[model samples]
Target: MQTTAKNALVSELRERIQHLEGGAVRSRTVLPFGVPAIDSVLPSGGLAYGALHEVAGGGSGTVDGAAAALFVAGIAARTKGKIVWCLTRPDLFFPALAQVGLRADRVVFVESDREEDVLANMLEALSYGGLGAVVGELVRLPMTASRRLQLAAEKTGTIGLAVRRWRRQTEAHDFGQPTASTTRWRVSVMPSEELPVPGVGRGRWLLELMRSRAGECAEFLVGACDDKGRIDISTRAGDRQDQTSRSVHSG
Candidate 1:
C-alpha cells in the first residue's frame, strides 16, 4: 500500500511537470544549495520554479525555524544576483545566516508588522524575476495567500519559500499551511543518535515531506551541514562503528 501511494504521488507530480513543460514555462533559473543532498532532492536540481514551498513547525522554537530560513537563503545565496527577504519577525539573525553561506550584501531585508504586507512584498519581488529568490516568514501561512504566491513564482520563475513561525501547538499544526506550493515540508530537530565516543554525537533531523508536486512523500534522516556547508554521510558509519566498540567494552 505504501508503494502504491508513492507511485501515485510520483504520477501526479509528473503530470504537473508535463503541464509546465508543454507550455514552454521554464523556471528561468535554478537555485542550488551548497549541500548536494538537498539539491538532489529538489526538481531541476534545486527547488521547483514557479511554485510556493513551505516550512512549518509543530512548536515554538528557533532552531528548526532558523535552519529552514538558512536552507532557503542558502539556495538564493548561490544564485547569480541579490535576493529579497521579507519578514514579519524582527529578530532574524543576519550573522547566523551569513555563517550558513548567505551573502550579506546580496540580501535585502524588509521588516513588516503584518503578514499581509510581507506576503505582498514577496509577491512583488518574485514577479520581477531579476532577483535570485524571494523568502518570507509569518506566524500563519494561509492557503489562499500561498496560492497567489505560487502563481507569481510560476510567472517569474523565482524560488519562493514561506516559513511558518512557531506559535501555539494547535496553530503550529494547522496555521495557514501552504496549498499551491510545489512542495510542503516539516523540519524538526531529532535527538542526536549516539556515537561511540562519549563526547561525539551524530546529528539527525525529522524531515517530513507533506506534499510534493514532482515526487512522492518520503522521509529520511537529513544529516547536519558541516562548517564548510557540506553534508557528510560517511561520518555516520564511523559513529556506528564506535558505538559497537563501546557496547563490547561495556559487556
Candidate 2:
C-alpha cells in the first residue's frame, strides 16, 4: 500500500490536503528579512518567493539542523499563504514550530520515510505554485536535481526552500558541492544573552550567508527569532556594519 504523509498528521491540520494545478503565473515577489542590514546584502533585496534557496546547519548534529529548520520556519511563517513541509523525519515538533510563530493552521505536514519520495513531493509542491512556500528536508542535493527544482520554482513563482541535512559529520562535506540554488546559508546556534538579574535572554545565532548569486558572502551575529518570527539585529547592527566595511572586497 502507498503511504501519504498528509493522512498521518494530527487532527489540527489533517484536512488541509488539496489539489493544485501546475504553471500558474504568480507575482515574483520577495520575502525580505526587513532589516536593512540583511536585505541590503541580497541581490534581490529579499528572498525571492519564486526561487530555490538552500539552508544547512553549521554542524552535522541534530540540534544544529533543527536550528536550520527553525530558520526556514521563521521565513515561511512570515508569508501570507499556506505552506507545505516535506520531511523524511517525523520528529518535527509542533510546539517548537508554534513557538516560532508558525501556527498549525498555516502548514500542511507531509511526512515520508523515503528521501526520494520527499524530493519528488517537493518538486510537485513547488510546481503547483499555490502555497507561500514549499520546504523539503534533504540530506543530499545533486546539481541536476537542484536545477530541476530551480526551474520548477521559476516557472510557477513559488518559494522553494531546501533544508540540507546530514546524519553524520562526514556527509556534511557534500554541502560544498555545486548546486543551482540561488542562495545558500549556514545557521549555527550561539549562546543566549545573560541577563543582569540571572535570567535567560533571547537565543543568539551565527547566521552565515555562505553563497549568493549577486550578493556578498558575510556572517552575522544576531538575536534569534522572536514570537512575531523576526530576527533582531538591533543589538549588533553597528558592529556588523563595521565588519562589512572592513571586509568589503571589490569583485
Candidate 3:
C-alpha cells in the first residue's frame, strides 16, 4: 500500500510540473517601462522575470523628481494582477499612485519601520507567488537580509524593484546597490519640452540605463508618465524625424 501511494504522489508531482511549464500556469510579464526606446534595450520588453532592478534618485536638482515609486506603480498598472508595495516612507500618497493607473484596490501597501523588516516582508510576498511584482524602497545602507529576498524572488520568478532614496554618494552602500541587481537605473526630471499645444507641455526624464545583464549602455530622454500611466513618444518621434532629415540632407 505504501509503495502504491508513493507512485501516485510522484505522478501528481509530474503533472503539476507540466502544468507550470506548459503555459497552463499564467506566464509572468512586466509593463513596458512606458518608454519605447527604453523598452527595446530590455531583454524581455521590460524588466525580466526573476531579477532585481534598481532605481536611484538625485539628479536634475530634485530629490524624487520623476518619482521612482510612481514609475513602479505605472508598471504595475500594466501588469495583469495585484502588486505588493513595501516601503519605509509613510507619505506614499496613494492618490498619486492612482493617477498613474495603479488602482487602490489591487495594491497591498505595507509600511515598514525598519529596512530589514521591509525586505523580509517583500520576500515573503514574492514567495507567495500571488503578486504580479514586488517593490521595496531602500533608504539606508545595505543589509545581509536582502539576499533572502533576492533568492526567494529568483525561485518564484518575481520581478523585484528596489528604489534607492537617500543619496547618490552613499547609494553604493545600499542593500540593492554595488551591481547586485540585474538592472540598475537612475531617473531624474529634465526641463519639460513645449509641445505643439500652447501652455501644454510634456516632461522629460533622463533615464540612465546604467546596468543590464545582456544589453550595452543605451540612454534616451523618455516622456514623462501621463495621467494614464502611459508615455507618448511624440518627442522621440521628432528626434527620429530630425535624424532622418539630417541623413537625407547629407546624402
Local accuracy of candidate 2 as per-residue lDDT tens digits, 1-251: 23455445543353433212223223336788977777888766788877899999884343349889888999888887889999988788888888888998999989888988888999999889778899999999999889999999987788899998877787888999989998888888877777669888888787888887766777777777776678867373334554244224222
Clashes of each: 4, 0, 1
Clashing pairs in 1: 50-153, 50-154, 141-176, 196-242
Model 2 error, position 107 (Å) = 1.1
lDDT of 3 by residue, 122-162 (tens): 87887887577888887652535556666676677777777
Q: What lDDT is reached at residue 17 by model 1?
A: 90
- Per-residue lDDT for 108 in model 1? 92
Output the TM-score of candidate 2.
Answer: 0.83
> Which digits, one per residue and each the tens of the lDDT, describe model 1 over residues 37-142?
4455555665666667887653234334865665555556656667788987777787867765676788899888887899899889888887777888876666
Candidate 2 residues lying further than 4 Å off, grouped into runs, are 1-28, 59-64, 234-251
**Please, what is the TM-score per model?**
0.71, 0.83, 0.74
Query: What is candidate 1's local distance difference test score?
Result: 0.65
Task: Give Cα distance to truth, residue 44, candidate 2, Å.
Answer: 2.7
Give me the overall lDDT of model 2: 0.80
Cα displacement (angstroms), candidate 1, residue 170, comes to 2.4
Each prediction's Cα lDDT score?
0.65, 0.80, 0.66
Candidate that beats the other on TM-score, 1 or 3, i.e. the better one? 3
Worst ten-residue run, lDDT, model 2? 18-27
Q: After superposition, how far is residue 34 of candidate 2 from its true place, in Å?
A: 1.0
Which of candidates 1 and 3 reaches a greater lDDT? 3
